[model samples]
Target: MRFFIVISSLSKLLKYMYYIYTHSSMVEGKRCMQTNESSKEQKVKVSGLTFAQLKKWVTVDLGMKPYRAQQLFSWIHLKRVISFHQMTDISLSARNRLDRAGEITALESCDTIAADDGTVKYSFALEDSEVIESVLIPDSPRLTACLSTQAGCRCGCTFCQTGRGGFRRNLRTDEIVAQLYGLQSSSNDRITNVVFMGMGEPMDNFPALSDALSIISDDRGICIGARKITVSTVGIPGGIEKLTQLDGQYGLAVSLHSAVESTRLKLVPVAKTLPLRELKRDMKDYISRKGRRITLEYCLIAGINDSLEEASALAEFAGDIECKINLLIYNPVEGAPYRRPDTESVNRFMHYLYPRCQAVMLRRSRGSDIAAACGQLGPGARND
Candidate 1:
């Protein structure tokens, strides 16, 4: 009787062990499947598509009605919904289909630092875990949101902290528009102006920039006026030509730190390839085609490009084109071998160009205290 009882006990123990092992294996398999699905979802960035593309995808690819496309567009771009589940107007089956198709990745606000001034700086977390920074400058009636076009810049402008970090990758069109949407959602004030002057060079990422412009300026979408959006570049001739070809009424700002070719080359290494004369001609052509005045962004670095002579050269360069000169005192970047001009020097420099240029405005560094000022944005940047 004792032997029979022991035998029964052993059988029960063996069965329990087998069940535990099988359960563990099943759990592991399920986890692996979940990971694979997550990765697949990451690959399909629905936000990367424009409204028109999303409409086509839904109507043609997902076998949904054409009207559903408009709803989807409004939900993502206008409403800024993070998930298809939040799209109440979309049917359950259609939502599931859209979910299976891809994921709608929105920019997560990692950190936001406000300056003593009314400027607010936001650090956005990308889908790939990379971070980009944007600035919101509150100027009473007109609130300006400065947007970044690339994760890091390759322009190699010595004074720019973004270039100091080296290039990562150009931001997609959706990523560009996401910045505007994110800002609108966060701020109480409406964004009246958008400037591509945050981190990277806009012209370097022209295709994405153009698409973003279209979505932002579209009345059916974000509804920002084309004139209110300004794209700043370190002078790319091909990009200027492309902008002219598109006949976009968007404003253009050239980062002409120094009007002299050799001086400009030193300041903007990319200028070595894109000479001042060629860039000048392209600007003239763009002005002629678009019938809009270009803004010359001159970062006046003390003892470097803030000399009266450089200012005069800049005035001469602006002679033919109807342009406004935005004289910005260099915002100090850590490790950058440059300094901001004193009040006297800044005034002197602007005084020289004031007579020659169409209009000259001194741009005060808004978020310099938080490293959110012009030429001061990058991973390496720190707030003082």
Candidate 2:
């Protein structure tokens, strides 16, 4: 396990370079860069901001005292207040002013499913009416929250259902944070960890993703330690480079479903542009700079990427790079051509690669019954 987590923190893990998702209000089907004039006069959403950012906004923009900022922080985060009227300690006048200036953004609960395996999945509606899902995975005392970075995904990994639904707009910072707030309200087991491995690729919406990370990790806020958070990506070169620059506080998981170039291209269409060779270079650079090992995630699909030849390639690919190869059994997706490998095939695949790689583990899917497994999130699934 030493080689599995040679370096501390997820700062060195996850993400890709280049993004097609743009942050702009749709104007006649055109997307333009948002402006500082309140995004052309849209009210601020205070839910996802860090304490320092909240203080600056309250003191400067909202004309509130510095101490009042702390009060708002406690009201919103510690107390988990949903509306301004709930802040009884704050002056009525202040509450009225806050209502006029900004909103304490919260998601509207729509539907939820509890898997027999103790995995609870929640579907919430965003302000724009986009539906996103989050999963609460129970493992004894530790319950992990898998949050989404976007409403849908841009990286069209053929094996993933989220990609099949096509990309929607990138989530605002507040929307990203609100998922955790929504999950906490539903689950009794204090969320012990978070994984940005839900609906979309974390790197496609890097700006909002980065802001949500800081806000989530801040002691005055949600306070989930950075190391307990993991950001999984499809190995974007630019995103990997940027992840290395951040303070090593989180874990990194790259969804390298296949190591062979030809097979990987088919699995992750984005691989056509961000070839495997470059992805490895940045991964190596991430280790050298952050001194942390990344977890290479490979989802074993029947017949497609489960061959012994693929195992040999993966071993050779991760040979010099310090990383833990995490093997996953494919979870079924509706309308997808792929099939889950049988038990014997999975055993053969895992055994062949276990000795060849520096470190390896077969991470079982937790919520297949409720369609909450990895690569199974998206629209068009009828959950019972």
Candidate 3:
């Protein structure tokens, strides 16, 4: 009787699986899939706008006086208005007009994790009910905010906790910029640097990421230089090519955790889709056009890809490319098979890279007490 029941369940499960495989395309073609975008009209974040765009918006759309644009910009960004009603400097009539146009980005701070070392991790609620993380690291004189470009990641890097969460959706420019506002407004330590190395792949969400960078770089606004901003990617082709067209002096970091193609594919699965040879070529072209050095991030894992031979190969791999190798100590994640390499092995690997390229062994920052190290930020933390 038990055998018969088991067989019946197996048969039913197989039938459903067969139907899903056959009709998968039909499910994908539906516009209103699972996202909340199905209900509310998609609104851009106010933090994502530049003074020029805001000026054009106020003058052309709202039919406000030219000087009013400057006042509005001051009220929103400089004053850090928490609510629309707080834009008291702007006339009620004009504010009502702007309100009707759906111009404001409604954001609510969800949660914050402040480490003993003054590193604060903030989670912001998006209009779509998805949450993204932004981290502020204050090392006295140098304050850095690690920002995210998407709600979740699609890069599928095997070593990453956030990437394992799978792709949710691209965050708007406003969502990205709101992170800066949140950090600056909440913390006393002013952020001097920003790195797009948090939750999602920055290059994948190119337009929104670029817009967020522009808003931060605006002189009359936050006024952060392009040099102070670092955009990291898993080596997307179209994104890298598009980056060449832009004339910003921002820094770029490539997550080149392994030099070996097979090993890299095992770690960063995107390598299978965008292989190293082509990626190297696109990156070389980017360096030529931009005329700047790029940072190659290498994560050292024990007994896996950190052997002396692999280190030597990595040196040869980075040869004369206008690049610097950032040897990162692998931040251990729960259920991850690999362990962090010892100091001896890490030094041996750095010795090989030093001869071939400009290299620096960036020590993992504080926050291990709170589990905020590299690849360690997520709901799935090791209990042991």
Candidate 4:
């Protein structure tokens, strides 16, 4: 049996190795993966950081003046330079210091699966040897990258595949930023939008998530507008408060899978601790301050939360908060005792909510081919 297990692990590793070989692009006489290896541990100067806590490196450690840091910031954030060698105008010695002391490029792309519908799902190995998944969905003119914030989720939402695996560790800011860079670097299509609706709850990994967002929204490099990035949380009020204090505009989405407390507790166990009332109040306060529409994400489960009464309750909940509603048809996961809401039932739920609040059916990109769809991330069980 021990020998059998060893063989099984070896086989799985070999399969993943083959996948990486087929997916990785070779350029300039070096594989992209090779460059990633060289910079993995460099201190990663924070002068013009897009995400994570790199500014401390500039202001505190680097001993550089604020203006110089600002300039470096612009070069790194605006220019999106992958290496310090690209900071041409800076002194060679200073550039060398940065190159040796600092580091970037954390997420290493292990494999990519491109769906027929122009959706691309990527698996990334984090610095700590854990894997997370991200998805890029192309909708004609607008392209959105769905990024994950954690290796696995602890929230344990019954319908989510990642949740079933239980929570691991939070991703570093660089890990988060690396996902965006990986997708943008490989694909011809530029990602115009981003969503924190991936493997882990954004609130669960607040510091890293916020740092990543700041960098992504920075005007210097990747320069993705703050308004184009949406951070989705499983209703963590404290994290929401921190977000509201930010200066620029960014969107928020709450996963309120069910309206009733009893049902919600079963669907999302964290609901018992956070509760819906406090979450609704905080959301209302945020909306009143920002004047931007808030989105409530409701995943409709067949015969569970899709009944007329539940729909009515959901519509009423939206009316009370004066927020927009995005209803997702539940994605089936292995061993999860849930089914997608039928189209007719989904339409009826939308019909009920439209009068009370802005409601739209979210068309999700299916990615079962690569096991990269919603609720489809986690280490799979060993096959016999």
How many clashes (backbone atoms < 3 Å, residues ≥3 apart in a chain or on different chains) does model 2 have? 9
Q: What TM-score would each prediction reach against the true structure?
A: 0.87, 0.87, 0.83, 0.82
Q: 2 or 3, which is superior by lDDT?
A: 2
Tens digits of lDDT, candidate 3, 205-274: 9988877887787766677788889888888668777777777877888889888898899899888878
Q: What's the CA RMSD of model 3 in angstroms?
A: 16.7
- lDDT, candidate 4, 241-339, per-residue tens: 888888667898888988888888889988877888888888887888887888888888998898888887787777767577777777777788998
lDDT of 3 at 10: 100
> Cα RMSD to native, each candidate?
10.9, 16.3, 16.7, 16.1
The stretch of ten residues in a row with the least summed lDDT in candidate 4 is: 26-35
Q: In candidate 2, how many Å is residue 371 off?
A: 0.6
lDDT of 1 by residue, 91-187 (tens): 7866766776667767767999999998989999987777999999999999999999999998889999999999999999888888888888898
Predictions in order: lDDT: 0.83, 0.83, 0.74, 0.75
Stronger candidate by TM-score (2 vs 3): 2
At residue 254, what lDDT does model 1 achieve? 91
TM-score, cand. 2 vs. native = 0.87
lDDT value for candidate 2?
0.83
Sorted on TM-score, best first, the list reads: 1, 2, 3, 4
Q: After superposition, how far is residue 61 of candidate 2 from its true place, in Å?
A: 0.9
